[model samples]
Target: MPVPWPSGSICEAGVEQGIASKSRLVDVVLDESIGRSTPDVEHERAVAIFDLIEENRFCPVGDEGGGPYRLRLSLAESRLVFQVSREDGAAVVTHILSLTPFRRIVKDYFLICESYYQAIRSATPSQIEAIDMGRRGLHNEGSQTLMDRLAGKVEVDFDTARRLFTLICVLHWRG
Candidate 1:
C-alpha cells in the first residue's frame, strides 16, 4: 500500500533547516497506478526497495521537520512525482520531474540490461563481463540524471539515486 499524503505545508517551520538530522527514508511506496512488471522486474524492484530502505540519505531542501521520510513514487500524466512525508505521514514535499531528459538513457539502459541478461545464459565469462560493464555504465548515467533532476528539491547520495533509478526503470518496464 502507498503512504497517504495529507494536504498542508510541507514543514512545520517556514525555514529550511534541520536538513542535517540524518534525514533519510524509512519506507517507500510505488503508486499502484503504474503498470505491473514481469517477474524478473518485480524481483529487481523488491531488491531495490530493500536496499534503499536498508541504507539511504534523503533530505528535502527547506524542510524543517527532522525526519526519516516516507516516499511515494508515482507517475502522473507524463511526469514522475516524488511525494515525501514525515515518518508519521505528514506531507513534507512534492517534487515533479519531466521524463523528457530520461527517455534516451532509459531506452539504452533497457537495451543493455536485456543484453546483459541474455549474455548471462550462454555467453562466455568475458563476454558477460563486458555486457555487465556496459549495463553498469548506463545505470550510472541514469542515476546521475536522477540526481540532477532532484538537485534542489531533495538531497541524495549517488547510491540512493542509483537505487531510486532502478525503481524508476521498473516503473517503465513494458513487459
Candidate 2:
C-alpha cells in the first residue's frame, strides 16, 4: 500500500489512477545515506539503473504532461521512498511503500545468489546452470511481486519491474 504524498506536493491530479506510457524516467538515484555495498552489489546497482534508464515505461499514476522524470530512491524510517521530480527540479510526488512485504523474498533471493556465486568456482557446468536457473526464478517471482505492489501507482513493464526489483534488493544489501 502507498502512503500519502507529502503535503504541498505538486500533484494537481487526484489520487493515483490509470497507467500510461506517456512518461519515462531519465534519471534514477539511490540514497547516499544508505550504507555502502559490496563490489558485486555496486555493479548490480549500476547495471540495473543503466538498463532501467535506457528503456523503460514509467509513468507516475497521476502526473500529467508526461516525463523525462527523475527518480530518487531511498530507504528511510523503515520504508522505501520513491521521490520523483521533474527534470527542472520540481517535485512531482513521493511514494513511500512498506518494506515488510518484500523481506522474505529478498532474503531468499540473496541466498540463491550466494549459492550461485559459490558454485561458479568449483561446480560443474550443469550444477552452475541449476543454481542460475533457481536464482532467475526467484528474481522473476520478486519482480512480479514488485509489479503487483506498484499496480495502479506506477506503470512499468516486466523488464522494468525486473530491474527495479534489483534496485530494491540492493537497498536491503548490507555488504
Candidate 3:
C-alpha cells in the first residue's frame, strides 16, 4: 500500500512556477489535494517512477532542497527524485523534488533507468532476488552484503547506494 501522508503536511499553495521563457522549462507544479499529490506533467512522471518502486516493496523516493535523496526510477526518459528520511516511527514524506528537468537540461532520465533495468535483468534469479532484498533493506547488513556483491556489476556508486539504502529504511520503518 502507498504511504499515508501526514496531516497538515501538504503544501497546496506553495507550488512555484518557473520564470517565463527560461532556457530550461521547469513547468510542473506540485501541490497537495485530499492527502495526495497533485503534480503537473514533469512532477507526475516523476511520481509514476516513484510509484513503480513503492509498489515493488522498495523505498518511496522524494526531493528535499537538494540534500541526500533517493532515485525511484529513470524510466520513460525521465528521472524521479524524492527526499527520504525517518521520523516519529514512520517514514517522513519530506518533499517530492526533481533534478534538472528530464527533457530540460537532460532528456535521457528514463533511458538511464531502462539501462539499469536491462543490465540487472541479465543476472540470475538469485541475484535478482538478492537485489530486491537489498533494495528493501539497504540499511541492514544483509542488504549491504547484497549491494556490495552487485556493486561493480551494476552502475551505482556507494553514495547512491547509501542514499537508496537510507531511503529504504525511512520508507519501511514507519508507524
Find the candidate with the highest lDDT and give its number: 1
Compared with the true structure, what per-residue lDDT tens digits does model 3 show for residues 17-61? Answer: 321111111122222221232334344444534443333212222
Expressed as tens digits, the lDDT of each residue in 1-175 for candidate 2 is 2233334333313324332223568899888866678998788788888988887667677677666689998878888888989877799889888888889999999999999999999999999999999999999999889878887677666777888998888777877
lDDT of each: 0.80, 0.78, 0.31
lDDT of model 1 at position 80 = 90
Ranking by lDDT, best first? Answer: 1, 2, 3
Per-residue error (Å), model 3, residue 102: 21
By TM-score, how accurate is candidate 3? 0.21
Candidate 1 segments whose C-alpha is farther than 4 A from its true place: 1-21, 38-40
Ten-residue region with minimum lDDT total, candidate 1: 1-10
CA lDDT for candidate 2 = 0.78
| Top candidate when judged by TM-score against the true structure | 1
User: Model 1 clash pairs?
Assistant: none
TM-score of each: 0.83, 0.81, 0.21
lDDT of 1 by residue, 61-174 (tens): 787656889999888888998999999999998999998989899999999888888888899999999988888999999999998898778877678888889888877877
Model 1 error, position 66 (Å): 1.7
